[model samples]
Each structure stands twice: as structure tokens, then as C-alpha cells.
Target: MVHSPLKLDTPQEWDLSDLYTDFDDPRLVEDLDSLQQTANQFRQQYQGKVKQLTPEQIVTCLQDLEQIYQKSGYLYAYPSLVFAADTRNTEAKQFLDKVMEALTGVDNQLLFFDLELKSLDSEAFSQLQASPALKNYQHHLIRIAELRPYKLSEEVEQTRNRDSLTGRQAFIQLRSVHLGEQEYPDVTTPEGKTANTEAELSALLYHPQEEVRHNAYSAVRTVIKEHNLLYGYILNAIAQDHKIENQMRGYPSTLQKQLIEDQVSEPVFTAIMEGTASRFDLFQRYYQLKSQEIGQKIRICDLYAPWTTQATPPLSYQSGVELLLAALEKFDINYARRAEEFFLKSWIDAKVRPGKRGGAFCAYSHGKHSYLLLSYTEDYNSVFTLAHEMGHALHFAWIDETQSYLNSNPPMVLAEIASTFNELLLLDSLLESAADETIRKSLLTRQLEDQLNLLFRQSTISRLELAVHQRASEGSFDHLFINEKWMELYQLLCGDSVELLADHQYDWARIGHIFFKPFYCYQYTASNIVSLACYQKYRQVGKAFIPGYLELLASGGSQDQVQALRQYVDVDLEDPATIRGALDYVEGLISQLETLI
Candidate 1:
């Protein structure tokens, strides 16, 4: 049993002593120097000899590469987390830069290894992939094979690796620091207080009170507008960087590259996009009802407003843990135990503070336990976020328990799938036990809004992303071009249910994904379509489905994405209605909310 600390924020910090003693840790410097040495030694011995290696030699070679990869993962994880906690910390920032530059150098040295492997003749490639000793790395070999067509020359690959530190990655680093260091003017609230950071203000966007939500929206707009020029410049640089890299790599299009990387076929990707976009009517209908519930026309700012004005009691950090653990217990005792370790062991950073990153992510290093980042506002959504991020932590944790480092990564959609599953589990647990109609209504509305964001909004965002990359390939991106593209997406999704706000067009200006990972948001749409169907299956079958679902998690990238999902939950990603099942589920939630209204 774990006892919660009296103050949540006090224990919210993770014990990074596990990763390093400090930025000044001699081991960090030693490890940085050692990475290049290891890479050079390995390359010197194996660069042109991959096809000549026996089974034992192949396994040994892979193990050597795995060691380097794991060390690099840990080295990168620490400074990145440190920077995330306080992007303005000059020491952490500088060390992060140094580490990134050093790793780039190391990777540049290793570039020739992959180029050599991919250049092998058909017989050599076949024999290596068929070796019994290399079975554990089969998935890794296949992943490498997937990139054969995209692999550039050794010199070009080396140049790209060397430039990564100062090119797109630098601009993304700036965006993170900029958002963290932003100072939004305080919005006075009914409780005689001010909301400061983006996370705090984001919580206000869902406040039951309309005025507070509007004020929060206005303040965010003011801050983003204040820095629009620099933000726009950063986005343009990122866009152009991708454009250059994508063209040089021979990728026909940006989305195609992302799709291949995600292990999703073009047909299934299109199915997800069209299936979700076809339901814009459901989106409009939900908002029309939401406008009536709020007793006013729903403004762009009013989108996240609660479906009710009912007040929710404040939940402390300790209580949030108990609540999430209790919810997890219904699924399985093991699930609860895994989640409990996150709180008791202090694997999570939960406090809302100045200079912390705006959104949340779970960082998993192959040999170390996962670390979670949450700008916890202690609201109801924060409670769900606790469960959601823990789902991610444990997903990778389970993978580590059973898989080798070579195949530990799942598709990016797995990130959303596990997180959203916990969210649904928590909702089901809440709705099953709660007697009050208002609480049930609130929970249902919360589910609806989440589905809205993950399904409808993300699909639209992906459409806009494709257009941005296309236009960006032709010329430099300007404010007018991005703004117009965004407005088009908003209108397509929202229909004419409410007046469109121009500030909404500037919304992409604040999205880090556009700059950091081109076309990354579609995975949310893809995962939601898959997860909703999985949840519905669980509801229908009860405990019978646990073994397969857990196996799916343990498989990591071992199985094909579509095949794994199909085997576990009978979900057919190729079918257009795979997402329609999710839309139907959302419609059901809206129906329940209607009755309560």
C-alpha cells in the first residue's frame, strides 16, 4: 500500500537521481564521449561485413547496437525531462543542446552502417533476416527494410543527421521553451484569483462558467497574438525543413512518409480520414445541442465548456491517485498494482507551475521505468489524465517485461490506444456507480467532448496538415496561408452551427505537432477508431478479452499493426465503418446526455 504525500506538488517531481545525479554528472559527459567511441569501433569492424556475418556474429552485432541505442535513450531522456520541467533553466537548456549535438555526431558516424546493410544483395539480405539467432531482431530488420526505398546516400544521410540538431529540432526546442516561458496576463475570476500558465488557462476553458471560459480563451489569444511573428517564423522553418528532407529522401508526399512510418497502409489511412470526416453532421448536431444546453450560441471559445454548470468538488493529488487506482482495479488487480507504483514511487510530475511544458507525455527509456509529465490542474479532466498517462507508462512497462530492446516500440497509435482505454475504463467505473444524474451527465459530456477532439477535430487537423505540407513544398509558409487553411478546416468540421472566429485560424500557430512531427495528429483519430471498438468489445465480453488485449500490449512492434488489432479485438481497420462504430458510440453518449437534459 502506498501513502500519498500531503501536498501533491511537493512530491510531483520525479527522482531523476535514477537517470543522473545532475546536469554536472561526470557520467553524462563520460557517456557522451563513450557513445562516439563505441559507434566508431562497431562501424570499423562491421560497416562492410554485415553479409559475411554468421548467425552468432549477427546476434552479437545487434546486441552491440542495442546497447548503444539503450544508452542513448537514457542519455537523451534525462536532459529532455529536465528541460521540460523548466525550459528556461539555462543550465539544463545548454546541456540538452550539448547532448543533442553529441548524439548527432555519434549517429552520423553510424550512418554508414545502415547504408551498408540496406545495400546488401537479395541473397545476403535474405540469409541475415532468416537467421535463427536474429529472430529477436526480426521486427527491427523489417522496420529497416521498410525504409530501403527512402534511404539516401551515405553522405546525404550523414549530412541530414549532422544538421538535425540545429535544423528542425532547434526550432521545435525553441517552440517548447517559448510556450513554457510565456506570460499570459492574469484573468480575474469569480474566486478572486488569476490563471497563469497555458495548462491552468486550459483548465479554465472547460470551467462550468461561461464568462471564465471566454476570458481564458481571450487571454490565450492575446498571448499567442503577441508572439505571432516569431511563432509563424518557427513554423515556416519547420515546414521547409520537412519539405527539404522529404524531397531528398524521395518520399512522394509528406503524409505518405508518415503513413509508412506509422505502419498504416494508404487505404486504411484514407478509411480513417473519410469515415471520420463523413460524420461531420454528428459533430454539428452535438454542438447544436451543446449550444442549447449552454443557453447561447456556441462560440469557438465555448467549444470545451462543460455541458452543465454543476460544481465539482476539488480532488487532491492523493484522492486522484486513489480514484484512478480504484478505477483500474475493476479491469484487473494487476492493472491497479502497476498504476499504484506511478504515484507511490513518484514516477509522475503532476504540478502546474511556471515554465513546465504545456501538454503531457509519457517518456519511456528502454531499460528504465517510464516517466510521466502532466500539468495537473486537479480538475476532473486531470483525474482522467492521471489514468490516461499511467496507461501509457504501464503499456511500455509491460513491453519491457517481455520484449527485447530491439522491438520494444509499438506503432504511434498505441500511445493513444492504451491511454484512451484507461480513460474509457475510468468513465465506465464512474458511470456504473454514480447515482446522481448531474454527475452522470457531466461524465457523459466529458466522454463526448473527448471523442469529439480525438475523432472529428483530429481528422480535420490531419487534412489541414496535408495541405500545409503540400503548399509548404511549393514556397515559404506565411501567416495568411496557414490561417486560411485552418479556417477552412474549422468550417468543414463545425459547419454553420456557430460563427467562425478568426482567432481560431491562428490556432495552428500554437500547435507544436505541426512543427515537431508533421502529420502526427492522425494517429489520435486512428487510435480512437480502434480503441472505441475495443472498449465496446470489452463491454460486451467482460473478462474474457483481457488475455488477448494484454498480449497485444506485450507484442510491441512484433506484429503487424492491422493484424495485431484484428486478432485481439476483431477490428478491421480497412473497413470504413471501423470508425463509424466509434461515431455510433459517441451518438449513444449524446443520447444519454439528452435524457438528462
Candidate 2:
């Protein structure tokens, strides 16, 4: 039986039995208390002596911290995901806010631990790690030491850290009001039929009819325009906050602080963005061809309009699971098996329901368990999303298994590698099994979509962000300035085919990252290039590439992006080849699509 789109206005529930049987179960409270006690004990014993502590003590403390942190993560993730998936859940809302408050208090107290550890002498630190446990964490120690230059005075640092919640965090929370509540009338298709809600409207954007795509785009814009003022305030507040912090941190350029935290250099970031921007002709050609395919003049909204006349046949949920697992099995059997486990164990909430979050994300609950949030529409995009999110889950599961809890989550640059790599593998596998020219072309177009999003859209957004920050810092921090800069970016990257209308000018306000992670959009472009190069190596070498991939994942927070890539991909980020290779890959796909047409 075919199911209807989820009723997003009402709260749809999931069976948390997969993670925990009940929030108030004895184990839940017991774990929280245990985690708190362990953290407290570790702090009491090693707070002052981290430098002088034995290597065994170092290892012991790290393991305990990971274990406790993981437990606390479970405590935090459960309600947080529930809250995000359904904003109207009052109990979940209260519980999550309470947990955040508690975590903030705990974080303030632990902020000094890392700064103090980084302050220790190399010789003394090495001697303490002489214990066998410390031997394995030498890389992590080196990483901590690398941050010494960025560490601030304890009093000042503590104050800065504590104040972040009320500033950046609060601003981001306010912005959430704009999302999860957008109410739009049903979007009408060419047949004069309506698909209710934005998600359905988004699916219709791919309809072969130009009228349908245009109407869908216009409908969504009308909804967005309604909340323009509040959204504008959120954008201005968040960007200004970043501008203030960047100045205080003494970052040399607009993006320097983000690049440093990403464990990359400014030159590397420039190489990635500049190289991609230089190849605009390749995308222009593709868009022009796509425009020809539709036999009409295409605009920016038409870029994502389905290029094929044939509707992509939808696979059932079970079949989608099999397809994802089958594709992942090409890389490693273990990858396939873990994904299969997720399907059978209810690790995924696949049901479409009201108040469930519209997007897909993998939430790793501090330790071994990982949960996936997706409002499944049972489309090909949904299957690809499952594959993508599962890739993230498996990566987290592996890192969590291999590293301390504190170290399991890698920097954002590395996080995208595994996810995008999974996508490349899926595309490669799908193309191999294509039964007809139509499916092959569709798959090729999907791949281009990936390239367009991560490489083109992200890079353009990055450029826009830099301009916005620089302009804001120069006392041009007004809505008009932001609109102008936003339009300039749209025109530059999207080419002459697309026009930015006045109402659409406030597009910057809708982006959540500008409010959350300063200058994070570029990482998508950075990681996209890196993933392409890494996947190319894997294709060239087979299982031999597995070692480097595994090592990169296992390294987690122990190494920076450049060192990690140096070990794995053997290409320096500053080299034009690193970015050029990925862009060339995009060009090759566009070439294939051209031939198909």
C-alpha cells in the first residue's frame, strides 16, 4: 500500500527502544550519575596533575572521560533529536533545554582542563605518558599542544567560553523559530493537483513541466517572504556576533579562524575555492545543455528541475535498504553489514509523520548507538539520503569504537569525507547496474547535483559569506548591504541564466550555518574536492586504499586536515591539482551527460 506524505503539523513519535527503553529507567539515571561521578573524580585527581600524571593515568583518564562523555551524549542526544524532529513536543523541549543548561555548567568547569594540559612542557608530558596507555595517544597529545597558540588566559577564556551560549547559541536558537513552522498552501502541479507542504513542493520541483517547477519555487518563496523581517534579524545578529569574535581572536582574514579550527591553512582554503571558481565555464556549459534539454530558457530554480522525462521508479523501504547495503558492500563487507544492522534494529525512523524533522541527519549518541532522522518520501533522493546518512553513522560508530568519546567527532572537514565518499561509491555502483540509457543519464544527473551543491553552491555561498562578513565589519552591517552581496554571489556563480529578484535578495537570512558555524559553508567545497581525490585513489588501488581511509578515520581529532590528507591522498591542499582534480571530475561528468543528450 502506498503511504501519504507525513502530516508535519502534528508530532509523530519514534520508538526510542532502540537506544533506551525509557528515559527514567534506572540505567538512564544510573548512567548519568556514573558519568558525573567519573568526570568529577577525573577532574579532582588529574586537574592539576595532567602534565605530571603518569602515561597510564593519562590513558585511564582519557578512557574514563570518553566513556562518561558518551553516556552524557546519549543523555543529551535522545531528547535533542526528539525536539528537533518535532518542535511542538513540550516535554522534549523542556528536557532538552534543561540538559543544555546542565551541559553548559559542566562545560564551564572543564574548560580549563585542555588549556592547562597544553601548557605542560614536552619532556614532562612525554615522561608521564611513559605508561603504555599514553603511547597510543601521542598523536592526540601533539594535537592538544598545537592549540596552545590559540588558548587564552584562564579567566578570559572561561568568560569567553561561558558567554558564547548567551550570544551565538541564543541567536541560533531564535533563528530556529523561522524554520519547523513555515506553513504553505498546497502546491499545484500541471494537472491542477496539489501536494501539501514544502517537502512535497520540493519533490514537485523536479517535475518535467516547467510550469510546475516555476510554481513550486514561487510558492516556497511566498512562504519565506512572510517571515523576512525576523529572518533578517537572525542573520544580522549571528553575523555581527561572528565579526566581534573573529576580531577578538586576532584572526588575520575573515575566514582564518574557521580554517585554523578546521586544521587547514588559508592557502589551502583559497586553492580549493579559487580553483573551483575558475572552472565556472564547465558548470555554465552543463546548465546551458540542461536548458536545451528542457527546450526552454532555464533559471536558477530550473537548475534542480528534473532533467529526465521518465519518472524515477520508487523503491520500497526494504528494497531501498538492500540497495544501500549492496552499494556499500562494494567498499567493504563490514560497511554493508553495519548498514543492514541499522535497518533490522530500527536504528532508522523511516515512517513519514507530522512534526518530524523534514531533513535527514545521523545522530551518534556519544557511544556505539547511532540514530538516523529522515522523513522518508520513498523517492530516489530519499534512498541516496539514507546511504549518505548511514555513511555518517558508520563513520561515527567506527571512530567511537576506536577513539575516546572526546575524540570521536572529527573536525567538520573530515566529517564530510566519509559521507561524500559513500555517495561517490553509491553513484559508481548505481551506474554499473543501470538497465537502460535513461536510468544511466538520471544517475549521471544526480551525480552532477552533488557536484553542484557541494562544489558550486557551497563555494558561491562561501564567497558570499566572506563578502558579508567583510562588509559587516566595515560598518556596512545592514539588510540592504547583505542583499546586495548575496545577489552579487548568486549572479557570479549561477551565471547569466539565473536572476536574483528583490524579494529573493534576503536568501542569506534563511541559511542556518551563518548563524551557527561561522564560515562553515566552505568546508563542503573543501571536503568535496578531498573526497573526489580520495575516492579516485580508492578506485585506482582497491583494498590498498582501505588502510589510509581507516587510518584517517581512526585519527579523528588527533591530526589536522592537511596532515590527514597528506597521509591518505598524498596531495597538498595548497597545490592547484588538489582542487583542479575534483573540478575536472565534475567536468568529466558534464561531458558524459553531454554525450548522453
For model 1, what is the error of residue 583's alpha carbon versus the real structure, in angstroms, after optimal superposition? 1.4
Give the distance in Å from residue 347's predicted Cα in candidate 1 to where it truly belongs. 1.0
RMSD for each of the candidates:
1.8, 4.0
TM-score of each: 0.97, 0.90
Residue 537 accuracy (lDDT) in model 2? 89
Candidate 2's residue-wise lDDT over 1-597, tens digit each? 112222233212356674567556677567666666766766677677666666666677777666666667777887777777676677876777776766665655566577777777777766654556676676667667666666776777767766766776777876664466666667776566676565666667677777777777777777777777677666777777777776766766557777766677777777777787888777778778888887767775677777776666656666666667778887888767776777656677766654555567888875567788776665677678878888788888778677766566688888878888888888888888888888788888988987978887888878878887776677646666677877877777768655445556765666667767777888888888888888988999898898789778766765566777798667566678878888889888888777877
Residue 178 C-alpha lDDT in model 2: 49
Off by over 4 Å in 1: 1-11
Candidate 2 residue spans exceeding 4 A from truth? 1-14, 22-42, 46-52, 121-133, 190-193, 501-503, 569-574
Candidate 2 residue-pair clash tally: 4
RMSD of 2: 4.0
The C-alpha lDDT values of all candidates are 0.82, 0.72
- lDDT at 429, model 2: 84
